[model samples]
Target chain A: MMSANTDFTLAVEELTVSFDGFKAVDNLNFYLDKNELHVVIGPNGAGKTTVLDLICGKTKSTSGSIKFMNKELTKLSEHEIVRAGVGRKFQTPSIYENLTVFENLEVSYPRGRGVFGSLMFKRDAEVENKILEIAKEIMLDHMLETEAALLSHGQKQWLEIGMLLIQDPQLLMLDEPVAGMSVKEREQTAELLNKISAGRSVLVIEHDMEFVAQIAHKVTVLHQGKILASGDMDTVQKDPKVIEVYLGH
Target chain B: MSFMYEKLLGGKNGTVGFVLLATLILVVFPLALDGFRLNLVAKYLTYAFPAISLVLLWGYGGTLSLGQGIFFGLGGYGMAMFLKLEASSPENTAIQSTPGIPDFMDWNQLTALPWFWEPFNSFTFTLLAILIIPSVFAYLIGVAMFKRRVGGVYFAIITQVVSLILTVLIVGQQGYTGGINGITDLRTLHGWDITSDFAKNLFYFITCFLLLAVILMSRFILTSKFGRLLLAMRDKEDRVRFSGYDVANFKIFIFCFSAMISAIGGAMFTLSVGFMSPSFVGIVPSIEMVIFAAVGGRLSLIGAVYGCLLINFGKTAFSESFPELWLFLMGGLFIAVVMFFPNGLAGLWEDHSHHIKKRLGFITSLFSKNDTAAVAPKLEGSN
Candidate 1:
């Protein structure tokens, strides 16, 4: 994995997102280096998800520039950003319950963004082989043909991660990837994230400090729509403001 | 192989069998019924057009359109005007004249046919009117509503109001609209001898074929990726919009498609029964279309067809057996279905089949050496 101190892969300058009259993410500035697994910790309503939403174009930043690999991201739509190699997993599993594990990957394939394109498109063997290979890596190869809804919650989370892997995105933003996972599943997910971060950047929004300490190379603490601290998990967890925010002081 | 089988047979062997049986019954129905009854069924099928429209709008698109009757009325009234003109010719003066001037001319009391009404006097013109008028209206309404981002109950209310306004305008201009009596005493439809048994059967067959074709088309659309996007839109409209899909365009396309379907049904209705009335295009009938779709299972294409058939069948049977109790029974049935089977009959069938499968599996497991122990380890591991 690339070192956290390497040159930035994603740079956000003065990013702000407001809903109604209240600002959800206010003038937040951050930069992520390539292959870095950055954990964003925030108390409830701290705008961690809002930041991810803005980055994925699910919510537009009011006035700011988001540069991904030096390319402007603010003008792109969510689907366009997805096609441009940015994958997102929602807090809730967004996988199609009726579709099989393999079919879920197929639906997110980058080639079918257009209506006419999808209608005429056929899945090539290369795409199929790649999906299977990724599923195997995620320990989901056996469940390829199983309906997504029938999968266990932890399995569903892994399957969603596998889907993002299939998309082959440069950056993957996952919201609460292991929120409902068991201890073993959380460890497995952390291992999977470590393996994935070898070739890509991963921004995980999580509240679990132990899980963050396990895999996060660097952590940023968000409070009331602003960054309170940024450093290694031990250092940030020990920060007075971070402790007070978590304890509702 | 299982996927292919499920896709072709609609998930189960029994479902395919039942569909085949239903198709056979419909094919043979016209032969058993008298001409009058066959004609009524044909008319009901025509009404199914608007119901199908409601299915597309409400079932798939998640837009409950209460203005389908407006489009239906447009087609019906358009055809009625032309038929009235043809029947009121100098050579046919012996036939009964309307109480006042023909309904189309009553509002203005024009001595000469309006430029717009002039073309409708021809069968070809009337046919064109049926297709164009409803489609144009749908396009305008769709553009206005969608561009403004008016949706949900707001959309439903707007559409309902549109139909309501049309009904009032038509009824208030009794001279031009035939008022409450509506256009009746129809005759030949483009010299087809509509009163003849052969023509009635032909119309019935045509209606059945149209219904089948539209159902098939709807199925084709609903199974495609566009259909998935539509469902995604229903579940997460904001997500779809953010995904860069032209949500407004999609709404307009679906709304217009539904209106066209409804208009065709209306034209068939007028042709078969030889009458066009304001009641056919009012809020009540529009609401009835939504009810049909709801009862049928709004998510399934086949459900729409089944719902139309079931509702119309009940209407016919109840009216004949106990006329006074018909409306009460229908209302009660609606309430019962809504309260007990929120997903409607399709969901009931699914739940029943799942239970049957569970029972069968349990029985099979009792005879086998390996059962609970084999599956339990994996279940525990997953947890």
Candidate 2:
């Protein structure tokens, strides 16, 4: 099973992490194929975020391997993981508040990752054009000059998505991309996620099942650091175990 | 008008501040004050370097270093060592048992020049050391601390301890380091009499030029993508790291850069004041340097200079008469700045500059009203 598999973009095999004695993400085997929009839904303490954390190198796994494009991710640092074509958006809208919307997207551009490279990084046409395109995609083109701090809750959320979009990652992981957004904003975000997940793999941790049904190509219901159900949205929704542990709420 | 702003890294207000600072330091200060007072102002300007460096390190980078005096002392001591070596020429020190070593070394019974001091005999080496040594030291410290993710108040406390340790080391080693009194009587630079009023004025211009050049260089950095990243890292370290930026690298770079800037100021302080003492390299001076940044508006580079000037002038004036009250006053001023004027003088200026500009524009418009003869707003348009 561990034989170099190029079929999947991300393959997490026997991934287990424990904080002292408590296992946060227990021996989990997860696979994400190219262009698949996968959603991980779980109740509180189910270690939904812990899985994302382990995959993204934010938290080190006690044992097991996470391979992205067959590259070992467990040993790589967080920034190195990001540079390896993986982008993770936090549960909250994390953005540079002092900077304008244009700057927010511009800062996320993939070029000039080195120390001096960033110092000499110019806002040339290629960069400007890319920022403009991503800004439009995220519906932030009109508010490009606005300070991120002044943006509405939903706009800030979109702004963060746009930041990740600017990186053009092969794998995008968002934790509750529409947690605090309005319903209308949620619908728009669902639309945005579906549209952007065409070429790259998208892994999302969300609780909104209706919103999940709208976007998930595949769904995995996590229960106490273990996958209780995994399949298409409809099948997972109908599963008795998923219903008892998660949907029953 | 905005197009012109685009040409300069800081845009309109930044360029204006740069020019205003230049004029004040290079022109107004020299012409307004006598040579003696001008020399004192130059000495004050040396302190401004560390303050300005703090603006970048603390204000933008979000790393508060309480031991800037370490780098400042390094630069000062580097310069002092060279001057002491020069002053201790065989002819100048013929009375000592050892004719060529420093007076402190002779007093402490040193027979030969220490290996470290031998390199300082070369002027080029001394200048390079002044620029490089502090940055290297900071780089090592930055790596040790930042890589380990030791920051916030703990990082600050560690730096304070480092500065305290340095001060103790310098004072204890009376033979090698000039001790608590510091290296003194720097007579000349390249055989020219630096102690004279003529040299004082000359060094003043040189310091001003160096200060302005560095400010421009910093402005360039502050306007770059790196600058934006600094703000990003400050706000969200994890976000920046996930954004593919090695957060520690940026912190280390800024830390090292700020140290180099502080060292330049230290070297200048030694040159202008003709002394490098342990008193200037300890926790008190380090904290005072931080206060200078705070008072000037840590976020504003030029404000840092003004902060240094304002606080130092306050220090000199209040301390002269009510010597005991100076510390209390300084503490009061810091608290006031933090409470009310958190942005410092620069933020205050930034907050009100627009209103002032509008009022000035109104005054100018009043005077020019008769010349343009422009019509008032059209009230006749159909609503």
Candidate 3:
């Protein structure tokens, strides 16, 4: 028990990634407790998304380790890490444009992931009902038959979140889930995020302070690949270093 | 019921397209063309196998391979090797210095049969080799490229390079491969005289039936969950990867599956055409095979078959009188398909289908109203 941080859903320690003599993420230590909705806010080029990429195994670290569920994630492949119950949403809306909303959700249903498994996968009532449940949860039930290409910008964002939600990942890392959303859409998204984070660890990288204050249980401000200030939203906002680097701008 | 129909066959429209192609090949071509011409069509249909495969790999899987001819040639050469060996019995080759070996090996001054060629003597081995050999080759290439994340045009160029290497290997090793002339003088398959007109006709029907089955198999893949995943991976590879899929595995499976399909066509090509040459195993034929897929409708499997039939018929027709201009025309057709008709022939059909239905009001009345309503929005959405 002393060897592992079982209380934390994710414990990233001494993580560093260097490219061409420049360390993009430099020995950063971050931790998330169970059911904690932690937000990472930083200016552009602050290695915010890089941290997400590192945790999800999209980008390999030069040193240090990322432990999730007492399992070292840095050594696993991207899909292997994902299969271990960690879902990541990109900053941009990355839903499949050519697929229908139903198909887009169905592809992420977390079953039949292997090549042969997918070929033999039958769409039973369980799958159908699950897709329907997620679609409705994401507020895209009416657009199930509609192609994702026709969805609005906000709807596309929700659909991307829906894609991650269907996986039922233990740790959900979202990169700016409301970047292009309208006020109404953002409100719905905040509510959706709140509902989903009830029993799971949620890590978000957001720029919008209002949305951050809306959904964040705790906030961590990153500056140049290192944590500058980490605490509740009020504490992060009041930190002189955070105001100087990010919030002031 | 409509969903069920769509599930089995692509949609109601696809069912029509399948039947239409079926009638054109099975019923119409045999009734219309003579034996010699029909055999020519059979040769053209072999190219359709690669074209149909491209629709699955390039169109749906979104991996453009310009070296399908390599797999086709592998299949052709495998069959040709067996046939050449069978034709080179001690009794037939008693005149040669070395009997019981391929004549080319004898001409090149080889005394014994190569160890590798021994297994090919069995017909069972040749049949299995047609499916397994190319799949293994494709699997190797798929792992080398897809695992390393080398895709799009880079992947295309590597496949072309593979075809070139295969061609050089075949032409360079004259004795074992029969060199540039290819392993010719093929006479029989399992003691049946394949050179006979009856055999040619039987082979034609076999080609058509085999092609239909291939199309159905490809459709089954496309409609399955794996099919949707392929399309998703094509559009958003990162998303698919993050969605808990080993994306490389999917690409490898499709590539191997696509290679096997092309190899089947290649084997048929040897049977129908009586020879496998380096000319058909190089970069040129490989790219030409892609043109067939592009012109047919890269997205539509049935369209790929028609594309092959149409382009190959044109190649045979124009090359006879204006051989010098045919290459230019082929090049021009590929450019035109890429520049303008990105989706190819079937795309045109889908785009204007509603209009065509409306124009023929009397005929369209026979179709269900719900079908038209169902497909109308799809047009505007895809484009």
| Reference interface contacts recovered per candidate | 0.16, 0.87, 0.95
- Candidate 3 lDDT over residue span A63-106, tens digit each: 99899988999999999999999999998999899999999999
Residue B180 in model 3: lDDT: 96
lDDT of 1 by residue, B216-313 (tens): 55654555556665666776565455344556777787788788888888878887887889889998888778777777777655665667778888
DockQ winner between candidates 1 and 2: 2
Best by DockQ: 3
| Isolated chain B TM-score per model | 0.85, 0.91, 0.92
Tell me, what's the RMSD of every candidate? Answer: 6.1, 5.5, 3.6
Estimated TM-score for each candidate: 0.82, 0.95, 0.95
The order of the candidates by TM-score, greatest first, is: 3, 2, 1
What TM-score should be assigned to candidate 1? 0.82
In candidate 1, which residue pairs get closer than 3 Å at backbone N, Cα or C atoms, i.e. clash? B103-B176
Best-to-worst lDDT order: 3, 2, 1
Question: Per-residue CA lDDT of candidate 3, range B11-31, in tens?
Answer: 877799899999999999999
User: Which scores greater on DockQ, model 2 or model 3?
Assistant: 3
